[model samples]
Target: MNKVFKYTSIALLGVTLAGCSTVPLTGRKQLSLVSDSQIEQQAAASYKEFLGSSKTKVITGTSNAALVKKVGNNIAAAVNRYLSSQGLANQYNFNWEFNLIQSDEVNAWCMPGGKVAVYSGILPITLNETGLATVMGHEIAHAIAKHSAEQMSNQMLLQTGGQIVGAVTADQSMAVRSGVNLLYGVGGQIGMLKYSRSNESEADRLGLIFMAMAGYNPGEAVKFWERMSNGKASGTPEFLSTHPSDARRISDIQKLIPEAQKYYKK
Candidate 1:
């Protein structure tokens, strides 16, 4: 039994090392025990199902919806260009899509693969285009950094070692399908992909740069975050669950602005 445990630990370490990957732009290394394409395919299907469900009211033909798409596309294009320049375009084949959902959720999220949903309730807080860009840029940065995949990978690592090793080695996609299911529900009920505080801070850093790349001023993110901080409440805004709005976060965003300004578009 001792020898068996030792070998299993060795095997797990090997898999962990083999699965290492670096996040784009931030250049942070992450473990990737699951397939990226598989997660994206799942997200696309979940996104379509959510859109088609009767519970989902997809707003369109209005300026708000149009603005969501515009902001999303601009950031996507800028991000794609950056990836291409970095020779990482092939690693990420995201079919970007954006939608505005008619819900008073006061939240927005970007799933794996470039699928984005902006809830109408957050519009008042956003106030204007630059504010909207701040929201979208931050949410999309979560996807670009593959935070979801990293979370799932960390979960996989936490499972019983022998079972996890077998599952990882035998069939990665099938083994992790449950993780996707846990994060998403096809009936227009999205289980929030609540990330760690570290992930949120990283997303903020990347988001500022992304918004700047899309021609929105990175400094505006501070104001948006300030508004969010002032309006913090209990258990209502889904955004706050994963994203804690406070003075420290705002300070961190302020600190990151100088680096992001380097990528500012005219």
Candidate 2:
């Protein structure tokens, strides 16, 4: 009787878990135990915390930061317009905000709900509005694709024997601890190197489409990456880590350009 109950429970759990999801643009089916709202809440909190801890440098003068914001908002508008056309507009509750931080880290990211940060450092490599659009589009693509929720779902499935499900719950404390640990592991193992390669490529593909749709030239993507690679050669060892180089990545991006061109407004 006990054995029967245990086996039956496991089977039921497995069946429920089988309803995984596949990301758009890249058909990677993932175990998504978390919801968009949950991810949005988490992202909002973290974004606020990071803003508190990190010094933010707002660009007001006729500087690169101003250019980045202009480009980023254009891309964001395009994304929203596209999502609306696809009948999935409700998926994003975007309150778009772009901030330029005074960091030489050559890094930028978009949190789940359209909070974006571009370091002053990456601007040199980005070079111009078109280059900045490429980077912003890629980061925003990650958010629109709901990668964070997908990652949380993966962790939940692994940790809870498929018992834990959904985004919000009575498991706040547990979820917080687990989420922090999961993010650390994801950043170190997935985001930084090996695992993120596929995600990076997918972002590039979608980013190109988004930027082109926003009226930016898709051709500039190749040159932007080349500049990035030149910078990488001297910076921290992202090569020793993972991610394709300028040449290899540009080749892949070029292959996707024909498809992206279809979405280009000009």
Candidate 3:
């Protein structure tokens, strides 16, 4: 058993090293054992199902909705342009879609293939177009950075038995597979919130640049996060939480502003 464990550990380390990839902008190395197509296919289907079943109405033809779409598209475009210039265009093949869902969740997220949803509850906190851009940019940065896939890959590594079961059950019924995927995806989102401080910080930094490239002021990110921090509900302490403290996050953003400003058009 000891010998077997040693071999398994070595094998896993080899696999991890073989699958490592650098995150754009941040230059951080990350595990990416799963293919982008695989993750995106799952995300697309899951996102569709979520919209279909949830107490959700897609907001359109309204000023707020238009702003959301505009900001999302701008950020997506800027990221695409940057990727293309870096010769990493093939790394991103997103069927980008942005929507505003009528919910009071104080949250927004972007799935693997650029499926973005913004909750109505967050709008009050966002306050204006730049604030909206800050949130959207950060969320979009998560997708572009492939944070979800990285998390899933990490889970597969840490949960070898569960990964084996998942592979074996891949041929199960659509209903069963969808159910599992949906549950896992939701759990992954929560897990993302609870174990992604470095990912969040990287997103914040990249988000500042993306928003600036999209023509929004990067400085607004500091103000937006301050509002979020001030309005935060009672929860875990910042040190123990998955996110950096608001003050720390704001200070980091301030430091990145000079670099991000170079991308600002206006």
- Local error of candidate 1 at residue 149 (angstroms): 0.9
RMSD of each: 8.0, 7.7, 7.8
Per-residue CA lDDT of model 2 for 1-266, tens digit only, reads 23333654475478447757666656677556667777788888888777777466555575776877888889988888888887777767877888888788899999989988898899898888888998998999888777667666655544553233213222457766466445444544544354456667778988998899899988788888888887544344544444666566878998998888888876
Cα-based lDDT for every prediction:
0.83, 0.74, 0.84
TM-score of every candidate relative to the true structure:
0.81, 0.76, 0.82
The model with the greater TM-score, 1 or 3, is 3
Ten-residue segment with the worst summed lDDT in candidate 1?
183-192
Q: Against the true structure, whose TM-score is highest?
A: 3
Candidate with the greatest lDDT versus the true structure: 3
Per-residue C-alpha lDDT of model 1 across residues 1-266, encoded as one tens digit per residue: 33434655686688789899998877888888889999999999999999999999999999999999999999999999998999999988999999999999999999999999999999999999999999999999999999989888866764545364444444446645454333223311222234466788899999999999999999888999889877554554545345544766888899999999999977
- Sort by TM-score, best first: what order? 3, 1, 2
What is the full ranking by lDDT, best candidate first?
Answer: 3, 1, 2
